[model samples]
Target: MASVLRRKAADRGKSLLDMILKERKFARSIVVLVFKATRLRLSRTSHKPGSVVLISAKICIKSNSFTRLVEAEAMVYVSRSTSIPVPRVYSAFEYKQRVYIVMERIHGQPLSVDWVQRSSTSKAKILEQLRLVADEMRKIEVPEDAGVSDICGGPIYDPRLPGRSHWGPFPSISAFHRQLRNGIVPDDIRDPESIPQDLRELFLFHQQLWGKPVFTHGDLSSLNILAKGDEVVGILDWETAAWMPCYWEYTAARDANPQNLFWREEVDKFLTPNPQAWEAEAIRKKYFGDL
Candidate 1:
């Protein structure tokens, strides 16, 4: 029954892709291979455009608010600065109030699916590679001429509400902290007033604990990381990527929930452990009350 439903969904995605191609006058030989709600739709085309191209499209409502152009631009920004692999953008545009992104379909499995089985030595090697990736990130200084829209927060693709479009491509770490304190999530926040007074202040106090802004993947859950053997082949889903406080990357990786025992024990191997984990937990506590 589940497989039947999945097949139906895939067919619908293929139909949607066909419509997109027809409307845009894009090549028609493309075939969709996968689909997911709020994630991405995967397809392949090998026609007049050039060589074989594997395209990943984010056209779902969960993705549309942020805009595909921002994700494409973010991927390009990181690809130019680091040896880390990312999908190349083919095109990004909007139709019917939906943002569509077509990019390289990376040919690797998500690290989350396989991390549990690897030996400790293999895990260490992978972590070393991740460390090198982080080192490359540190060297990427944000542009001096960048504006508020281009500052450290979610990409300012839409001028609507700076916080609404994305988690933040915020003006500063302090600005992000203010957003958290104000309970400005794009979706919903449960009873913001129920959060304790001191905890709210604690959240604000942490904002002053600053580091120079640096480039970050923003959300580096194992799902975003792709691997083949012990090496990470690509990192996907840059919709949340930003230039934020230096400690932001470490905080994100360490706070990621390890879904299994092996992953639980091995979580710290992915990035250098730091104080952001505790701070992040404190932030969560303020909003969600005891997790």
Candidate 2:
């Protein structure tokens, strides 16, 4: 019900409706709509195979879809930082309280769970590719007020939004734990609260370690990637792009769920163990309790 309503006194994630209406210049003339995946589109006209044009909105959730529009703009703004090839953004505009951007739609099947099943694919190759992207990503200097925010879209007021201030990390990990059981985590939670212990602690540690608001595409799962000949060609679905920790981006790249989180194994091996700090912790634990 709240997702359906307009901005009241308090709200965080900008209402898709209000954002478009406010930025009339962007949304003008453009009919606002959503994209669905029911029909099978074949190569027609000059468009190549698998070319994504437009579709109904039955499949996409409004929040993520709206976020994609923003990321499309963000992609253009940060074009220099993108390592993976992306469909060039043609234009950006908003309409009817929903925003949109025109882009050179990719003509390849997006990488999916099956794609991760690269047996002969050397881990070295994936790591090399990830490092290349990471190298390009680190070059980006996210503007202080640029694409930045934690993952949340409740009706609560987001200062980043038109009206509202956030405490911190809206839809906190505690909240996300309930919502996030897609891959490794199971859906039917037996001991629901059990998640709070091991994982939450690690999440908190990483949050502090990479707390600075930097830019990252939150939904960097396999499905969003495009591959051809063992290489990542396009990084599609920039919807969840926002300010986040530097490490967060890498963390996402490592989360190859279908094959277990091994794709990230190499990256994690290098990053997690800060030799000095790890040594200090070891010594401290030797003297006191490892708590």
Cα lDDT of model 2 overall?
0.44
lDDT of 1: 0.58
As for model 1, its CA RMSD to the true structure in angstroms is 9.6
User: What local lDDT score does residue 228 receive in model 1, on the 0 to 100 scale?
Assistant: 86
**Tens digit of lDDT per residue, candidate 2, span 100-137?**
55455454555454444666454446546755665665
Inter-residue clash pairs, candidate 1: 152-169, 152-170, 153-168, 153-169, 153-170, 154-168, 154-169
Model 2 scores a TM of: 0.49
lDDT at residue 290 of model 1 (Cα atoms): 36
In model 2, the Cα lDDT at residue 12 comes to 18
